[model samples]
Target: MRIVEDLRAELGDRIVTEPQVLQAMRTDRSGWVGPGTPAVLVRAASVADVQAVMRLASVHRVPVVPRGAGTGLAGGAIGTEGAIVLDLSGMRRVLEVDVQNEVAVVEPGIVTDDLAAVLAEHELWWPPDPASRAISTVGGNIATNAGGLLCAKYGVTRESVLGLRVVLADGTLIGVGRRTVKGVAGYDLTALMVGSEGTLGVVVEATLKLRRISRDPVVTIGATFPDVIAAAAAAAAITASGLRPAALELMDAATCTAIDDLLQPSAEYPVLAGRGAFLLVRTDSAAAADEAALAARLIRHAGGEPEVSTDALTGERLMQVRRSAHPAYARLGEVLIEDVAVPRSALPAMFAATERIGASHGIPIPTIAHAGDGNLHPNLVVPPHLAGEPGHIPDVVWSAADELFHEAIALGGTLTGEHGVGILKRRWLADELGGDVFALSERLKAAFDPLNILNPGKVL
Candidate 1:
């Protein structure tokens, strides 16, 4: 209470201890479990405000949670008891854009889509287009090291970031990385900080690497397979054939039905209806048409019907459906989103295992994948009637999810591809890293925040 009074006195209305506001800031999109509500909410307007909050929280040895837009799939943005939620979504500003040097300096609150729009003006682009980019913040993307459809050709958020302005646990502001294209100075702390999940320090600003927008004509290929295995095989064959597409994605039978039923019940949107598996492949290469033709042929070889399109509208509609897949499921029931990734070659195995797991667990799992990269999001749909009822805990659902995670690890893959290990997956992280490596990770956490004040109970 004294801390609240002090914060309100110093920050005025910027520090919100109101019950309603605190309740709203409790958790992010990962609604598997409700969060322990924090006592203070600081809507940070500038770097100086963040510094002030961090300084006070450090002095009092209170936990601090940094949140951006609350679009994160992981529970990384969930606030804990007695903590201060440092909301950075208010600090939206594009500080600088070095066109010649191919870099843009931005505030943490800037939305990914908004930044892309600004970049378009300079004929430059940022490729980390996560499905939630329309609402996800640049800071959140960096925290998760997020990857999207284009990640197969370009890379994740880590690749596009060059420098970061961070605020340490003790409220000390420091710049960790360089803005130049190549810099091997000291340690590569910038890379370390990118996916730290706001545990090591808080990101205030970033200098991001930009790419020039491609002028070559792009082609999109949509295909349907008899089963997910066939689609995945086609993806593998495409990759093996050395015909790299700009983006390659897959939606399983149940997912295709769900999307079609939700978006276009009367008619098929993107022609995804009545398909056991759907694949969308896009290429912006110099030989874009040739690559698309080859991809279509590969689809045929793998027993799929390919639908080629050079029209931007139709292709974009296909992509829009893929992006909207996750949210669309939320309308049906309690959607337990699972992020598991395996080797591209082992994709067929992953698909098979998911089917077996779902059958065993008696849960309906609809999966969609960035097939080119082997990242799959399996939506475990819990019927509306069964949700939040007494003794109806979705432990049965997680039992299947447990199998999915282990299967991914066993197949030389990770429990999470783009999403970070927040509260949702921390239980499995130790198993993935082994004891020795897990201990070393804990040491890194200790070295950064001796008091464990920054985003406590995350990552490590």
Candidate 2:
């Protein structure tokens, strides 16, 4: 199409059409989805540039995939055939920080942790911190309503957003929500777009509500269990106890071993004992006595052995271990990550079911979880060679994943908790939303994007 020529002339070197460059942008953190080459990528530096790209795509009836840092796990950023990649990584600006009002206005490309750091200077914070916060963009977080360690207490990214600047499929720019804390404005379109996964509109800017930054010392607790069921039981008990922690994470034996090898190659299990599956608990407290007592009591009640660390630096370092749990497994082999969630009450059963599925498939499925939120990521590692081989391994991996996801649905849960139904989970969406409900969703998609050009093949 000559439109590529137009974009290249208008965007100069900012537009990339080379095969290698386009190929590089085709995958994400997990690298498990589309390998479709985009016709071109427009590296938008300003709102006007984004508008230009959108205007062209709208007129040409070309699909445009809004992209941020491309850190999505569910292939939300992957492009389809002959599409335009509206790259926003160049618009990384913090527009406004209203400390008194507890809000910040930022462009789509602002990195999550960087925004958090900027807010921290003014004594404010954004709590939805995905593990990739260091690299993921605000736009990606908004698209997925991304959740993380603090979601159990502070909620997800959607809760922090007060407003959005979205570009419609027809190239119209509309602002939704407000800077003020409360507004009954039109329909609640702001919330609708928050987790739309780029299916409805392309988010350009957002007004985010922040909380007062805390200097309260962190308290760390570690509890070890014999198996995943016991580990899940401890997690449930902790939640039932009514104590809100800054972070609650679970790691299985394989992941723990991987982490131990990287951090302390010479140390044995005694150094990092409580090994089968463990929970890392964190809290903000000023006194050691209270945090210590709470940890000890909960661990004993849940049939666990407790290890507590109240030193600030030490506690932070321990949390790093929890944050790196998934990546640690990636070092071992090719991974198919599963973000399966279930009702809090079904956590033990879910954990038991996962173990059973893994054994039945003969695949070593290691797990990590934001347990307090009932979100588990059970990763099935495949040696690249084995994945390519024709055998029960690939069949087994897919079967185990299907069983786990179906079980989550049967237990009154959704297919995914944080990751959107990007191409991977599209078929099962009807199973969760029902036929009529999913039909209505498709109608809504048609209503907003009649041409169906916005992130085609994503989320119905």
User: Could you give the C-alpha RMSD of every candidate to the true structure, in order shown?
Assistant: 1.6, 2.5
lDDT of 2 by residue, 135-161 (tens): 999999999999988898789989999
Best by lDDT: 1
Q: For model 1, what is the alpha-carbon lDDT of residue 38?
A: 93
- Top candidate, metric TM-score: 1
Clashing pairs in 2: none
Give the TM-score of each candidate.
Answer: 0.97, 0.95
Candidate 1 lDDT by residue in tens digits, 1-460: 7778877878999988778888777667766444477989999999988988888888889999999998888788888889999999999899998999999999999999999999999999998989899999999999999998889888889999999999999999999889889999899999999989999999999999999988899899889999999999999899889887889999999888888777874433665667889999999978999999999999999999998999888788778888878777877677778798888998888999999989988889999999888899988877565688421337787788889999999999998998899878899998899999999999999998999999988877
Which runs in model 1 stand beyond 4 Å of their true positions? 265-268, 389-393
Clash count of each predicted structure: 0, 0
